[model samples]
Target: MSIKALVAHGSTNGSTAQIAERIGEVLREHGLDTEVRPAAQVGDVAPYDVVVIGGAVYAGRWHRDARRFARRNADQLSRKAVWLFSSGPLDASAAQRSIPPVAGARRAMAHLDAVEHRTFGGCLREGAKGRIARSLITSGRGGDFRDFDSVTAWAERIATQSLGARAEPERGDLRT
Candidate 1:
């Protein structure tokens, strides 16, 4: 059976979309079927075996649509394998530590047994934002800080674990 992964992301300046596509590519390379789509375009999470939800973080919070998507599909999602990712912290220094998602949001995510969450460094495009948004980004000392190797490694792990679980049982298989 082919494993299907739904990669959904929300972005303002498009960095999150880039991150999501990178993940989809990695999963596809591992022999899994993957679809990359925007959070708004993902109508139902029920069809996918594994759902990878990602979003841009602004002001220490995930984009509104991403949060709403999770909430709306929480019941169905809680029963399947789900992975969550956030693209934020645009510099290497900030990427070293775990940056928690918006206050209560992390707590809400914790309730899902099959969910795994990750935070990735993102990019800030020059001249793509208004004064306020630009100012906030600048104040945070932004720059592209994504670690491609790390991202690929994480994707590989998820692919391994999820696919392994779905593998057919063999005679005398220890797991069975």
Candidate 2:
């Protein structure tokens, strides 16, 4: 059977979505069939063999929708090969720096045997639709900082490892 991968992300200004697409591209290049979808659109995680969950971060926290999705699917996710990523910290400096997830999320993720979890820099658009988005963007905090190469490399690694694990047969051969 062909390996299947699901790339789900949450975005406010489209940066996280772009990152998700980039990840999907790399996975496809690595020979895995990938489906890139929004977090809200993901109906079920059980159908996918490999699940990549990512979202944009604001004010040191992931999008509420994304967090909710993770929480709702925690059980199913724990049973499968799962990976998590966050797009935050605009600019190269932020890209290199490490920012821990919010206390609540950290606690929630403690039990998950996640294959990998990463934090990547993301982008911010100039205009904000409301007070919160505008404040975060204008607070001298938001800008495009995503490292496409790094994102692609990580996706490649996941694809390689996931596919490799599936390729191995469960039982050894006994020759006559």
Candidate 3:
């Protein structure tokens, strides 16, 4: 059976959503069935064998939609193979070194027993929806800071791990 994966994200101005989509693409390339969707739009987590949740960070907190999704699906998520990611650093720090998850992400990780978590650089561009985003763009502080190579590397690693796990036969199926 093919492993079904879900890449659900909470994004403000679409950069994080694009990252989620990239992750889904990578997983699909590795032969896992993958779907990308907004966290708010996912009503249940039971259909997927693997779940990857990502959120945009603002002021050191995860986006509200991601937090709520984690809370609502806590029980189901804890039973599945789960991963989490955050995108918020406007600089190159994420690519230089591992950026720890924000407090909310940490809490969710503990609550859901997520297998891994990654942090990636954020993007801010012209016409972003918020006043701060607009001001940042005007001040030349906004640009596409996302590291897509990093995103692809992380997703590939996940595919390998998931595929290896699926290759192991279940105890019940290992009859002598």
TM-scores of all predicted structures: 0.86, 0.86, 0.95
Please state the error at residue 59 of candidate 1 in Å: 0.7
Best by lDDT: 3
lDDT by residue (51-161, candidate 2, tens digit) is 787878777788776787788788877777777788877667646676666543464366456766788887877884557767877888766788888888888888888
Total residue pair clashes for candidate 1: 0
Ranking by lDDT: 3, 2, 1
Candidate 1: deviation at residue 38, Å?
0.8
RMSD of each candidate relative to the true structure:
3.7, 4.6, 3.2
Clashing pairs in 3: none
* Model 3 stretches with alpha carbons more than 4 Å out: 171-176
Better of 1 and 3 by lDDT: 3
The sequence of per-residue lDDT tens digits that candidate 1 reaches over residues 1-176 is: 68788988888888888888888998899888999998887888777788888888877778776787777778877777878888778677435877666543574366545356788887886664657568856686667888777778878877887678678555221111
lDDT (C-alpha) at residue 165 in model 1 = 61
Residue 61 shift from truth in candidate 2, angstroms: 1.3
Q: State the lDDT of candidate 3 residue by residue for 17-91, as single tens digits.
A: 999999999999999999999999999889888899999998789988899999999998888888999999988
Instruction: Give the Cα-based TM-score of candidate 1 against the true structure.
Output: 0.86
